[model samples]
Target chain A: MTDQRDDKEFAAFLAGESELADRYQALGSEQPPVELDEHILAAARDAAKVHRLEFGPPGGWLKPVALAATVLLSFSLVMKIGVDSPVRYEQVVTVSKESDSTLEGQSEPVFYEQLARSLPQRTLEMKNMREEQQSEQVIEEVTVTGRSRSIELKDAPMAVSILGSAEQSIDQDAALLIVAEYVAMLKTKSDSGRFRLQEMERSNESTAKEPALTASSPVASKKDWESIDKLQTEDDSESMLREIVRLYTSGSNNEAGTRLDEFLAHYPDHPVSVKLRRRGY
Target chain B: MLPGMANRPDDKVLMVRYRDGEVQAFEVLYARHKGPLYRYFLRRGLGTEPAAELAQEVWMKIIRTKDRYEPSAKFTTYMYRLAHNCLIDLSRRSAYKITQQVIGDDIDVAGLPATATANPEAEAIYNESVEQFRSALANLPDEQREAFILKQESGLSLADIAHVTGVSTETAKSRLRYAFSKLRQQLIRNRDKA
Candidate 1:
């Protein structure tokens, strides 16, 4: 309790209620030398200046903004690659080849030859239409057996339309004709094959002069009728032979039998006729 | 006496403004606390030169670490804590011995300027009582003397004294009480002898 009383008295003395407070206030007053204050204040100014430079206005927020911009730019580049460049011209060509079963196993030159031959006769009308709309540069050159020719079918932009028009009229013989043309085009690699192509053309010409092969005939298909009409008016022996082959392969057995008999009566010595006889046609 | 005590800003606010490169704020703070801080070291057994050095060291530390200063406690408490640590560090170094002699023994008491009193004899007696108080204050233990000085000089409360001295409020109060009792006893003995 005495200690507590002393504590209260000391608290009162600290509050300046005692004479000791007055005496203590009269104690010596000393100040730091002016030189020391200047030295320390100069040091303070230097440190504050350094700190101002270190955390300058741009230093704090610019780093994150630049980082975010870089990330956005990279993301946009990846999106452009993924979204815009999806299909290539080369891939379209591949898909076109894969869809056609007959074009399988053919070399590129042979494939072009077959593509040209298998195109429908209506493609001729489209060729006339295309010639009006496009420049001659639209034609692409193809090389077969060391002989390069500019065929209308190559690089033709209307290829899908050509196939679409041929869907109803193309018979088995037209398809086989495409294969045969591919084989003949590939065979032209040798001199013997060239001579054979020339001989076939000559025999076709000779058969055109024969009256029996020129007899009037009925055709099953409108396309075959067009070819026959063309043969009658123009006397194209190649067209006649193609029509006969079309009738034979189109399941018209009786019409093909009559056309074959009449053709063989005039051209018994024809190489194609001899080949047909050997094949039991 | 230090200047610019009229309507001063908060000490922590002054420190923060100084941290933001306003040197004028620091000048105000230095002017406000320089005398009390110097006297604090002077009365704690340091010679005038060493006490001045310690006072400057404490301000320099305050300036250096201004960026890290949080206003959690009173700025006076923070400043005194730094002063306290510097004294402890000086004690550890033992480069300057802490003496137990009366603070008045280092100076000529007659050379001190007389207090402004109309009665010269009363002023003389007042000077003697003041000198005796200083001697008694120096006679107290270092912790008690430091507590008393912090309370009287910096106007720190008992809790602030505890915070600055790393003691509990009760312990700070006890030290101040013992210091007051000792000084009062010494003054009474001197009065009786005279």
Candidate 2:
């Protein structure tokens, strides 16, 4: 209780209600050494200067941006030196020897050969079309055909159309002569294989050679047809012989029988005719 | 600290100037408060070297954190609070129990006995009793001594003291009352004996 009373009196003394407050206040706080004050104040001034540099309008943004750019440049250099670049253009050219057609009847080996032979002409037509579109300083034109990815960059602009706009057709007369010769050689293999002593009377066979060989006969030139019909090779004769045998095997007996007679008249001494005779062709 | 010195900028105004990119303003503020801050740590019984280092650290913190300064409280309250926290951090770092041992623990605190003889050469024993009074002040408990020193040094009100010390206003008042009761008794007894 006495302590509580003394507490009030002293509180009053601290509040300057008594003369004792002056004497207490007269007991002054100690002073720090002059060196210490200078050191601390110098630090404060330096810090204030740093703050101004960091947040002052232009300097603030510029330092950070330059720092960021430098960091990005460093990272880019590290990546360039340390990591290997991959080979970007890897090419595997696969020649497809197998036929893709699904047709089941009447599509003979000769027909497929003809289709394969037309491929170069078809590519020439597409190249012609690309040339027609641009006449500039064409640095390079590389066309990869037959379904393989190639390792060429199309550095120049090209309008490459792979569809049916290309009208690349072989001469109709040569195509027909090829078919006709094939038919005759095939007939010789199946017919009685001796030279027919009588010539194929041209007057008798004139009707058989009428507009010729399809629902839509080829629009071939007369001179071209004459030239192609007059030309022949032994390998072509063998292939043609195979084609005639196919015709007979397919049961076109009347046509095959007459064509056999014509083939014997044309190539009477073809050595394989003797074999046909033995087979009672 | 004087009420009549209104012509001079207050601590808060100088802090605002420093916050607004003025270095001279902070220098003015540091000059005003360095002595009181140094004495606050010195009286906590930290040796002169440690006390000087701690005081320097407190001012550094104020400078470093000037951008975050707000005028919600008096600058003296904020400054002493930083000082108080610096001392607490030092106490913990030193791993000393009874971290803040009041002012003279490092220097004047030689564990003097409760009696003393007056010097015959002195005209009055006022000077001698003052020293005794300081010893008695140092002998107060940590919180009570802190309250008395803050009141004497910073002249903060009870509410501001409470805010600075993270205590209630009533707790601050009670601490101040206890400290005053103790220090007053010691000083009065010493003066009577002299």
**TM-score, structure 1 vs. true:** 0.54
Q: Write the per-residue lDDT of candidate 2 for residues A1-281, one digit (tens) a residue.
A: 98687767876766756544444444455566679888887887777778778776334577898899999999999887544432132223332334323422222222323332333443454355444232222212111123211111121111111111111212122222323333222223223321121212221233232122221112223432232233233444444444444344344445544665566666656533433443344
Restricted to chain B, the TM-score per model reads 0.88, 0.86
Off by over 4 Å in 1: A1-7, A56-281, B1-6, B105-113, B118-120
How far off is each candidate at the interface, as Cα RMSD in Å?
Answer: 3.1, 5.8
Q: Proportion of native contacts found in each model? A: 0.55, 0.52
Taking chain A of model 1 alone, its TM-score versus the true chain A equals 0.26
Steric overlap count per candidate:
0, 17
**DockQ winner:** 1
With candidate 2 superimposed using the best TM-score fit, by how many Å does residue A249's alpha carbon deviate from the native? 57
RMSD of 1: 17.2
- What TM-score would you give candidate 2 relative to the actual structure? 0.48
